[model samples]
Target: MFLILFFFTGFTIIAFISFLDDIYSLPSRYRLIFQFCGILLLLCQVYYSSPYSYWLFFFLSILSVGIVNAYNFMDGINGITGIYSLILIICLSYVNNFITTFIEEDFIITIILSVSVFLFFNFRKKAICFGGDVGSVGIAFLLVFFTGQLINTTYDWKYLFFFSIYGLDTIYTILFRLSKKQNIFEAHKLHFFQILVYQTGFSHLQVAAGYAISQLLLNIWIINYSASNPLFYLPILFLLVIMHFIRKKQGLAITIK
Candidate 1:
């Protein structure tokens, strides 16, 4: 009971500030402070119940902040967040049911249904509603919590593959920006999906579907083979390398104002 209270309280804190940022365009530092506070609350819960090593907790803190911001950064187009998150939740549901029961099945179902509803409105060329920072960061935090639970239950780091698609895109984009001596925090259309949409003439739905499908395929592989053999990551790595090459080919000369 106390665990649930702490978790929800932290989520509320993050979501409330994120929603305010959506409406008022709050400063990034203010948002980060609240985000850190919320994540700290979550870490306290972890500490009280099934604590890990200090280094692991430290790494999770950094990763949590990065994922929350990455989810916000990647929410640039219609249906991407809605579709991607829906697929991810479904995959996580499968893990919860079949692989390892770390979290409640009902909770995953609720999130799955919620994302489905969001997709109904947003998964179109002309979206009726945008996720904004609130929707994106809130869902990201939930995902981090759930994924953390699963990892802690099974003690397998391979679960991190669940976030591979977004992580790859976010990390590669940051490196690309750094190579050009650009401010990594500044908004730009250099993300692989963004380049596909703005530069390659793919429709928004098309790019969104492609990303979701790619992640789904990767998840399938991870669930089936990656668990038994670590070498399975080779194919996944090869695929990501190909994606990076394609993004570079398309985005190298593009400039944003």
Candidate 2:
């Protein structure tokens, strides 16, 4: 409980600072510095003696920072971060139920519900506020922590595959941009979600709703499959393709943006 509180405090601090930074127009370099500090602090608290070695721990620390930033990048539209956060939390919840080891359901459930409440307000049209970079970093930190714990105990390397949607989209989009000689890290409205909103004229809420529902259904199917099955994953790919077309027809493909 104390450590969970620490997570909230750390992220909330980041979010608060980000709020100021957003309003005051702080230097991008300063904000990056703060984000790196927060990540280092969070990493310091995470010690793993479970099943992995120092090398894995070191790798995860670096990966968590990258993921934290990647999520911040994806925060180009409303509901994207919150929706993704909620999906991951729910996935962790289901993961808690089926897996015998490293149960942290209470903390994970609390975080999910808390974020869901936050999303209800933020994911709306003409939102009160965008979830600034701090919101992005904070949630990413939480997910990384949980993910590490899950992989540590379950020893399931394939669990990472569950993040395929976000993983593939962000990575591919970056590569595509780079191939075209574009700055991969810079802010641009080229992501799938952004394209969907701008080109399709789809209501922001509707697009977010689509992603949320799709993620919900996908996670449900994965949970039903009981980690033993690899074959079920193929069908998920088909669904991904179908969803892409639906968005494309609706003028929502991320690539089009």
Candidate 3:
């Protein structure tokens, strides 16, 4: 009961501030500060419940913050946020039902339903609305909380594969920006999905559906075969190489322009 309260309270703080940012254009620093505070509150519940090592706590804190920001950064197009989040949440729901049962089934269902509603409006060729920072950040925080709990319960880090797609895109974009001497913190449309939409002439729905499908396939593999082999990351590595080639080809095109 207390854990649920902690989770919701922390989520409320992050979501409320994110909502404000959507409306008021709050400074980045203030958003970051509150984000950390919110994550800290969620982690506090974990700390008191199981008392893991300080190192683990520190790592989870950093990871949680990164994921929250990554999720927010990835929310740049129609249907991508709603679609990707719905797929990921559905994957988590599978884990809850068949794997480890860390969170409530009803809780996951409610989220699925909410994302479905958002998709009805946002998944069209001309989106009626967007997830915005509040929607993206809120769902990201909730997933982080759920993922953290599952990892804690099972003591398996492989579950992180659930976030592989977004994590890959975020890391690659940051590195690509750094190589060009650009500030990664600034807003730009360098993400692979963005590139597909703006540069490759793909429709927003097409790009969004591509991402969701890729993640769905990846999640299926992770849930089935990853536990048996250590080389599960080979596919992820292959994906990285593909992304590199695409970006390289596109990077040259941008240069020629």
Candidate 4:
């Protein structure tokens, strides 16, 4: 009961502040400070965990806060963030049972699933709140912590591959932008999803589906690879080509030098 109360309090406070920030156009630095504070409070809630768990959640808290911002920066279109969160939550629920964690497994899944449903409505066409820094960061923080718990229990680093799609997009987009001497932080349409949205003439739903589908396919492959021949995992390029083909058909692929 206390633990649920702890998470609910933390989530409510963060969401409310984030809602305010979205409407009032809060300053970035202020958002960062709030993110840090939120992360701190969240850490305090789980401080009673073991030394290793404590350290893991601590690392995850900091990183989750950053990822919250990362996802926030990238979420310019409709349905994207909600879809992304949904995918992560579903995957976590499916994967968590396989790995043991001190955190109540079903509770984490229930909370996130509930959050995603509510956020979906809030984010659809008319966003009540833009997920602001709070929503993005909180989701990121929680997901990463969940991932950490899984990693700690399973001890299988291959699970990291599940997040490879996001890492690829975010890292590649940043480097690609930086190479052109552009401000990587500034809003730009260089992201593959953005390209599909603007260049390919894909609807927001289509573009969001593309990303979710690609990642889902990769995760499916991960599940299969774990059971059968690891050798089948080769030819990632083939999969990339298919991904590009589908995105291009929708109108988003650009010729890269």
Each candidate's lDDT (Cα)?
Answer: 0.86, 0.68, 0.86, 0.64
In the range 3-32, model 1's lDDT, one tens digit per residue, is 778788989999999999999999899999
Q: Per-prediction count of colliding residue pairs?
A: 0, 2, 0, 5
lDDT of candidate 4? 0.64
Consecutive 10-residue window with the lowest summed lDDT within model 4: 248-257
Q: Rank the candidates by TM-score, best first.
A: 1, 3, 2, 4
> What is candidate 4's TM-score against the reference?
0.70
Which lDDT tens digits does candidate 2 get at residues 1-257? 55555555656656666777767967767766666666555544544235557787667656666677677767777787888788878877877887544655788878988898888788877787666766776777778767766766767655665555666567656765776677675667766677667876777778777766776777677656656776768756776676467545754333342
Scored against the true structure, residue 237 in model 4 reaches a CA lDDT of 53
Between candidates 1 and 3, the one scoring higher on lDDT is 3
Over 4 Å off in model 4, which ranges? 1-17, 40-62, 98-105, 112-116, 119-133, 224-257
Q: For residues 104-177, could you state the per-residue lDDT of candidate 3 as single tens digits?
A: 89989999999999999999998988878999999999888878878778877778888888999999988878
True-structure Cα RMSD, model 2: 4.1
Write candidate 4's Cα lDDT for 2-36 as tens digits.
Answer: 65555556666666667778689776677667666
Query: Pairs clashing in candidate 2?
Result: 192-254, 196-252
Candidate order (lDDT): 3, 1, 2, 4
User: In model 2, what is the error at residue 96, expressed in angstroms?
Assistant: 1.7
Report the Cα lDDT for candidate 2.
Answer: 0.68
